[model samples]
Target: MGIPALSLSGLYSLKYGDCVRLPSGAEIGYEANVNFRNSYFIPDAVLRTVAGDIIAKEVFPIHLTEFAAFGWAWPEHGNDFMFIWTQETGVVKEVENPDLYNRLSQDLGETYFGASKDMNVNTLWIFNQLKEQGRFNSDHCNTKLLTW
Candidate 1:
């Protein structure tokens, strides 16, 4: 499954059992509740490249609300989030929590995924490809410049 493009229109916080109108005009509700896990937040750089639309500075709080409502887990590792970016659709794709994924997967009796060093390198490659596609802007990228 392809990750859905960030629908700026549907970007909003949701609460437990709250109804949401998706960009597709479908009304949906959280099957569960949402909560934010700061410990799992992927760094800004990773969010900007793979799932940029959802990570604006002001959106963190909303993101937290949505995370718990949807029972999502934030992936601590960069590569794991990118893999998520490659597999889901709509705002659901922006669900970058690996911890959440593992939990849900276990509940649903699905296999869990782990990262290898090679997978990490591949995620970097995908980030570069996104840059080429104009899905990323270097200016928005979080980077450090060192002067000697």
Candidate 2:
């Protein structure tokens, strides 16, 4: 972005004397930013260590495709995130694989479920049901996962 009309040099005056001058810090301002994380794609290592065993038995079938992030959350404060993989914390938006979602939705015909609301429940319920059917047994990534 271009500098705003008023910046360090314009906001303050620096007078140079015969042998004296303003300290280096007093003459300018600098700010820089660098982001290293992607909005999506949690690293594989994090998923295994942070919450794998627990998720395996409790939330099977919904194995993480990749990546993870953790934080404290509360439902009453609207800080609780959905317990399903999402592109951008989306609750009902299309899942990463629409084919998988369609298969699950079709399989669960009339069953009702949700997480915070109906959509997430439906998705989670599908995951459980699919797991029961062994649909995820040959998942490509799972075959390569080295338990940590």
**Per-residue lDDT over 1-148 for candidate 1, one digit per residue giving the tens place of the 0 to 100 score:** 1122122112312212223222222222222121223222222222322222332111111211111212122454442221221213323323456564555433322221122212322222333333444422333222211101
Q: Pick the candidate with the highest lDDT.
A: 1
Q: What is the TM-score of each candidate against the true structure?
A: 0.23, 0.19
TM-score of 1: 0.23
Number of colliding residue pairs in model 2 = 6
lDDT of each: 0.26, 0.23
Give the residue spans of candidate 1 off by over 4 A: 1-101, 104-121
Worst lDDT run of 10 residues, candidate 2, spans 16-25
Q: Report RMSD (Å) for each prediction in the order shown.
A: 17.0, 23.0
Error of 1 at 12 (Å): 37
